[model samples]
Target: MKTFGIMTLNFESEALYIDGIAALSQSCGMECFHFLPSSINPLTQQVQGRRYSAIEQRWFDDEFPIPVLIYDRCFYGDDEHSKQCIPIVSWLKSRNDITFLGFGLPNKLELYGTLTTSRLAPYLPHSQSIKDCSEVVSALTKQKKIIIKPINGSQGYGIYYLKKNDKTIHVKTEKNKKIISRIFPNETKLCQWLQPLINFRPYLLQPYLELSNAASKPFDIRILLQKDEQGVWVERGKGIRIGNTGGILSNLSAGGSVIDFSTWSSSLPPAGKEYICSELNFIITNLPYILEREISPLFEIGIDIGVAKNGALWILDVNSKPGRKVVLQTDPDLKETLFLAPLLYGKYLSQSENKERKSNYEKTLYH
Candidate 1:
């Protein structure tokens, strides 16, 4: 039987999800192991990890050869340990003998720049890097309301909504599950407060579109698309994330709630409903092709799309290592299939006679 490995940053992280995949791997006639990139031996090409036995319901002490296929779940950070493991993981990704499920996507700004040049440009908000404080003043003067987000941030952290009044700048953000508000007397004050943040990390600025409902809750459509065993892209599920009333973000991590996509879409008027369905269908059909051609062969992606009050659709974000909460909450019946996807894809990669392994880990975009 082929050995499938689940690699992560910490060994103890995602305990339940890890075991669920391991249990299903045994049922699918594959041996499952869990390990870290630091566990790999550079000289011997061996891995020191724990193998799972479904019958025993526990990980047993064992050593094994390098896995035939890897399901990478590593979320890189800026710590020394995380920094140390990045090169190790990159080296593993560079090997032609080992295959990964998804090689991950580039940072937010890179993704946005790529999509802006594609057919989706009409749906993209005008964005630019925060190179000068004057740029923010210029964008605010033109658009009235603008948003600033870290180029590499996730889970809605460090996102600020800035609305330009005649002489004051109003800022709102979610911090520690609470709404944080501040008002700057003028552009000079706003720039003073923002200069430190800009120096802290790189940020991308976009004109903020109003996406709240009648109840004042912000929302966006979260869609999950995954490749099946036959190497075809399939929509697993999509749902609506309604955030806190008057909040700036709709991320579940930022205290947002889920609503079934069908129910939400059905509540719309005929024209609104028609617009959403048509545009979403167009995106779902073409997005996978876009990523594969421009990025890499991905096993799954989570797409965040926001619809404006005027019925305009905008692609907010794209993630290669997307969460399952949106799909699992809306469609509980898809639970079994969701857990089975990685293993089935791994098996397909192992059984195929063609050696189509990846050496490039989507690194060219950084330049």
Candidate 2:
């Protein structure tokens, strides 16, 4: 039988997500293995990880060859552990004998930088890497209301909204599920407050879009895109994520609620609704393919799109390794599709490889 591997940060952290994929792998006539990047032996190409034992219906400690195709879900961070293992994953990716389900996107700044050159530039906000304090001050001066986010952040962590009111800068963030706000007297103070954070990891700046709904809660349309059984891109689901009133982020991790996309779209004006919906369709359909051309092939991506008061749409962020909270909350029916996506795409990749190998062999015989 065929096998698929889930390459995650750790086997324990992603157990739930892995279990869903494991169950589907069995139903699809395939095996599923779970491992961390650190567990692979580069020399032997053998992974010291747990394989899902079908007889026991649970993961058991075992050794196996690396899955032909890896679902790279290893989330990297600025921590030393992440730094240590990046090379391992990098080495794995460089191997021609194995294939990855998705090669993954670069950091936010790089991602936006690439998309800025693509046809999707119109839908992207002006973003730049924060080199130092001056860049943040200059952007804040020009765009009084701006956002400072860790370029490598996920789930709305380490994101701040800064609004300048004369000499004062108001910064807002959510921590431990609580919204916290602070005031800095001037540029000097604001920069001082952000010094440690900037020193910790690279950050980016963007003009904060007015993404709140009429109720004054920040919101955005969260959509999940994935390759289907036939290896074609398809929209799995979409949901409206509404944050607390006057909050900076609408990410569920930042204290947000979910609503059906149609429910929110139906409330918009006829023309506005039509335009927003049209642009969304265009963005989702074109973004994955364009990013692939710029970066690498992707099995799935979660796109966070924001619409301003004037009905202008912006691609706020692009995530290669996306979470399924929004979709699971909004469309429970899609649970099965989300689980089966990686397995099906893995099969697609293997079949393609086998065909290529056969064609090459036939050519050799003829030659």
Using TM-score, give the best candidate's number: 1
**Least accurate stretch of 10 residues (summed lDDT) in model 2?**
358-367
How much lDDT does each candidate structure score? Answer: 0.85, 0.82
> Clashing residue pairs, candidate 1?
none
lDDT of 1 by residue, 1-367 (tens): 8889998888887777788889899877789999888888888878888999888888986788889788888877657777777788777778787888878777888878778777878878877899778899999998899999988877788999999888889999998779999999999988888988898789999889889988999999999999898778899999999999989999999989999999999999988899899999998898878877877678888999999988899988888888889888998888789889999888877777756645258452221
TM-score of each: 0.94, 0.93
Model 2 accuracy (lDDT, Cα): 0.82
Best by lDDT: 1
Candidate 1 lands at a TM-score of: 0.94
- Per-residue alpha-carbon lDDT of candidate 2 for residues 1-367, written as tens digits (9 for 90 to 100): 8878888777777677789888778877788899888887878878899899777788888899988778878777667777777777776666677777777777788777789888999988888888788888888888899988888788888999888898799999988778899999888988887877888788888888888888899999999999887778998899999999878789887789999998888988898889998999999889989977667777789999998888899998888788899999988887888888898888888777332211111111000
In model 1, where is the ten-residue run with the lowest total lDDT?
358-367
